[model samples]
Target chain A: AQTVTQSQPEMSVQEAETVTLSCTYDTSENNYYLFWYKQPPSRQMILVIRQEAYKQQNATENRFSVNFQKAAKSFSLKISDSQLGDTAMYFCAFNVGSSNTGKLIFGQGTTLQVKP
Target chain B: GAGVSQSPSNKVTEKGKDVELRCDPISGHTALYWYRQSLGQGLEFLIYFQGNSAPDKSGLPSDRFSAERTGGSVSTLTIQRTQQEDSAVYLCASSLRGLYSYNEQFFGPGTRLTVL
Candidate 1:
């Protein structure tokens, strides 16, 4: 069985500053995918960024990026130039090895507050 | 393009009553998944449907929970004799294909279920 852990339960960042949300997982598979999803007050789940385990380079999507360390089993999300709109609950998730059904296992989540 | 949509956005039912939540996946998506989100918790995988294959009910918490996808489009999750513990937001996501295909999923706004 695989599991994801988000050690930080709450985080706050000043507007225009940067913030990093930590995530770790346990899996023996060599190839997999990591994802960060955001849920706002409106309760909509939005895809933030994704990283492929095989790729040594980190994944960046505009202001959202991920530092994916395969060996350490760590995949952290970094938000640059944070804005008030970035205040939400962020989740780290991924599919287990070779599961064709696309079921995702998610972390406990980090409540990020981007202060103005 | 329309994303995944769920119906009965906010449903409140007394405990012991039956409730049915609906999810309409994006057109052309072959894979759909259902997840539960409790207060201050991560998303919990509940069920998944892929094309005509047998649905994955492994993540379902109990026998009282059941779900079905009709004609590979709309899905319905039903809770019979619901308990207060069943109160949570039910979310639906859809992807171009199954997990093995490595397609990113789009999520719905989710239906908030309140079992009073």
Candidate 2:
């Protein structure tokens, strides 16, 4: 069984500042994928970024990037130059690459608030 | 190209009643998934469908919960005898491929279900 954990229940950052949301997972599978998703008040779940466990290089998408520590089983999201639009509920997810079923195991979301 | 879409953005139903949530994945996506977001449980995988293979129902909470994907494009999640605990946002996502493929899953604006 695999599990994802987001220790921070809530986070706040000022506009133009940087913020990092921490995430950790417990999985025995060597081949897997980790992801970060954002859910706004509109209830839309948006994919922020993703990282492949086999790849040593971390994943980056514009202002959003991930610090993936495979050995530590930690995948944290870094949001640079945060904006009000960044306010949302962020989730960390995990999926096994070898499994036929692509079901994702998600962490308890961390609510982010960007203050102007 | 249009992203995943869900119908009945908001649904209000009474306890013991039945409700159906629909999801339309991307045209070429071969994998679709259903997830539930609630206060008690942040985000949990409910079901998964990939191409013509057997759907994975392992994540379903109980027998009252069931889902079906027709023609490998549209999916409907049926919740029978809904309870207050079933009040949550139902999210759907789709990806290009399944199994070994690490395609990013695009999500839809979830259907928020409120049980009164």
Give native contacts recovered, as a fraction, per prediction. 0.69, 0.71
Clash-forming residue pairs, model 2 = none
- Per-residue lDDT tens digits for candidate 2, residues A10-104, read 99999999999999999999999998989898878888998989999999999999999998999999999999999999999998998887678
Residue A56, model 1: Cα distance from true site in angstroms: 0.5
Question: What is the C-alpha lDDT profile of model 1 across A1-116, one tens digit per residue?
Answer: 79999999999999999999999999988878889999999889998998878889999999989989899999999999999999999999987547678778899999999888
List the DockQ of the predictions in order: 0.72, 0.70
lDDT of each: 0.92, 0.91
Give me the candidate number with maximum DockQ. 1
Against the true structure, what is model 2's DockQ?
Answer: 0.70
TM-score of 2: 0.96
TM-scores across all candidates?
0.98, 0.96
lDDT of model 2 at position A50: 86
Can you write out model 1's per-residue Cα lDDT over B32-90, one digit (the tens) per residue?
99999999899998998999989989889999999999999999999999999999999
